[model samples]
Target: MEKNVKQIVEQVIKDVEVKNPGQSEFHQTIEEVLTSLIPVLEKNPAYVDAKILDRLVEPERQIMFRVPWVDDKGEIQVNRGFRVQFNSAIGPYKGGLRFHPSVNLSIIKFLGFEQIFKNSLTGLPIGGGKGGSDFDPKGKSDNEIMKFCQSFMTELYRHIGPNVDVPAGDIGVGGREIGYLYGQYKRIRNANDQGVLTGKGLTYGGSLARTQATGFGIIYFVEEMLKEAGKTINGQTVVISGAGNVAIYAVKKAQELGAKVVAMCDSSGYIFDEDGIDLPLVQQIKEIERKRIKEYAVRKPSAKYFEGNKGIWTVKADVVIPCATQNEIDLNDAKIIVENGTFAVGEGANMPCTNEAEQYFLEKGILLAPSKAANAGGVATSALEMTQNSMRLSWSFEEVDEKLHGIMVNIFKNTRDAAKEYGFEGNYLVGANIAGFIKVADAMMAQGIV
Candidate 1:
């Protein structure tokens, strides 16, 4: 923490220090936002004068539980589950619940903290929250998944509702995972509460365009920026990281706009298809076929797959969409990316780049959009799902998609305007930090001190 900023916030700092023994990720999230929002507090005296910072950083509720289920061999497996409802001033707690092996309280808190601002930037009525577990879903049997989800929801259903914390999906938790969780929620609650969850199967209460919402939303935001700058995605060579849901849709939309997606990756390795990646093959493999990205070479024999731990940042391109995990691209990778003529980086995942990587981009005047701003599409659509549920009506695919486009466009403009106001001139971290801080901070101030 910086001395001057820490000095001003010493009281709140002490409170947090006493409460938290060693949750580094959670502390990092808080320190980052608190360090940046000093200017916001200066202008909005109600924020500082009222101690809004303290309240905004704390979670409204944190739920922790154990999920015990029988695996295929009739073996008992126990895993921890968590949900950190970070805020509710703007709207209900809306976010995703990942089911990866890496899920933890610290990670969820960091994600939920970032979500508060991300949801605010969408200009939608959604508050920040996130949940997940350390349960590894990979290679798990369908029966095991059903049992695990049922056991997880057995305890989780008590904490969630339509107007309360509504979790969708993240990393390992997708439509299938959401379906299992939703089914359990319904069975336990004995109510057909459609609003209790988002990211359902379209055959059920799922919204249209929800599948491609986050990925398409990234392109939608970039398109708005490009339109304002009198440029376009047409003819741009893009390097996209990750072969997941967000990355696949980003590739599809960029190609639709005539951009050439040259690279994409997975945990095993990255693939570079100079002739342009086949978006359909990617969709088929990752989504439908449910296989590794190395299969891409099998489909298109010309595609090059580089094994080992390397990321996609080494690819030379005009735009870099980091759709991978946090810290996937570091300072060295940032330099390589900038040296390779990369002009913009739109984060498709949460904190995919390190602080140094971000600083390198900002110093070089690259168009760096933070994950909170760039990847709010999923939660934004989740909010739309809640709206439909509350109204007892479902919107058509086109309707929800158009609304998504409008919201993304608005978010881009807000970030741009905030940057210009802060003298950061297109520094999206500052822009997004300031823009999102204002709304929640104001609401917190008006509510008065607790």
Candidate 2:
């Protein structure tokens, strides 16, 4: 980057930090993405002249609301809700609604900002936005959960529509939450607006294979990367963090691909089964029983459960997929994986690896699949769901799976080619950021300043 351009970019970043105080996650992502785009800014002064980065860093709209609901105990409960419509240059706002207690403006902004590029890479007509509440669904009763969802939707419905913004599930949000929220949306609008949300129950408007999209998509992206390296998933030892929907299905797909998944985890802890994780047992424990990962050890004596989420990175493996959450893997975790000779790390969770960890993987020459490109399966399929809803037709599981496979394969090739084009050959972090950014940038430029 030229000295003058560098100063300009630095000033923009400085302005962001000064304006959005205490938003560490948002600040981290902004620094990581804009720094990677320095080459692009240098090569094309139009983006700088138009102040693309300045406009991009600031969300088009940010909604914060207080959600008050009655619990099963007839007690009033309150939580904060947020919806960050980060960008919509190409299409409608597309992203997920998280329900974790950890959700905040910074986290939502980070996810939404990353979604701008992720959706662009899909080659689908969807932009980026995210919304959710800081309501933990862990121990809540079904009725209580429904009450919370209904109350959250009462305020959110005004800001969303099929062609405006569509939200899906993430973290503490899932089928049950989607169902409740969708029901409330229907009640408020007095009309069926199925496309207004994704991840709905199959009996409603949800697309087939929607549940498996992210996990399966991660493997599909990884498979292409491995093939480029003249390797395959077969006979590889895999350790995945998180035993949620993403991790469990990733285990299923990887096992089907002939890889031995040795470990999986939850917020509480992780379990290691060297002989290979029994997919059925894990599915039963997590999906059906909704139990902690520690139960895997008790049920299967061969496996061992270890407390703490970070320790999962220590176990040696050929591949490591972080399906847990943002910043799950830091520089130290990257060191452990690189030292252990783990060659590839695919992210199933959004921004699962910190900037330092991602840089370490790149420095070590590991085949790293960044989250925006790798985990785009979920949102891509959500777009498919939107299509199904619009057309009033449902495709079979096999059809959706095949289309998803094709999309993931294309994402890998696009990311790779973008890296080669920008003199950052094989650097997917840069490649993904650049590839995802260019499409949106062009669209934004065409649309003019909004």
Tell me each candidate's TM-score: 0.96, 0.99
Off by over 4 Å in 2: none
Per-residue CA lDDT of model 1 for 93-134, tens digit only, reads 989999999888888998999999999999887888999999
Per-model CA lDDT versus the true structure: 0.85, 0.93
**Model 2: ten consecutive residues of lowest lDDT:** 1-10
| Residue pairs with backbone overlap in model 2 | none
Best by TM-score: 2
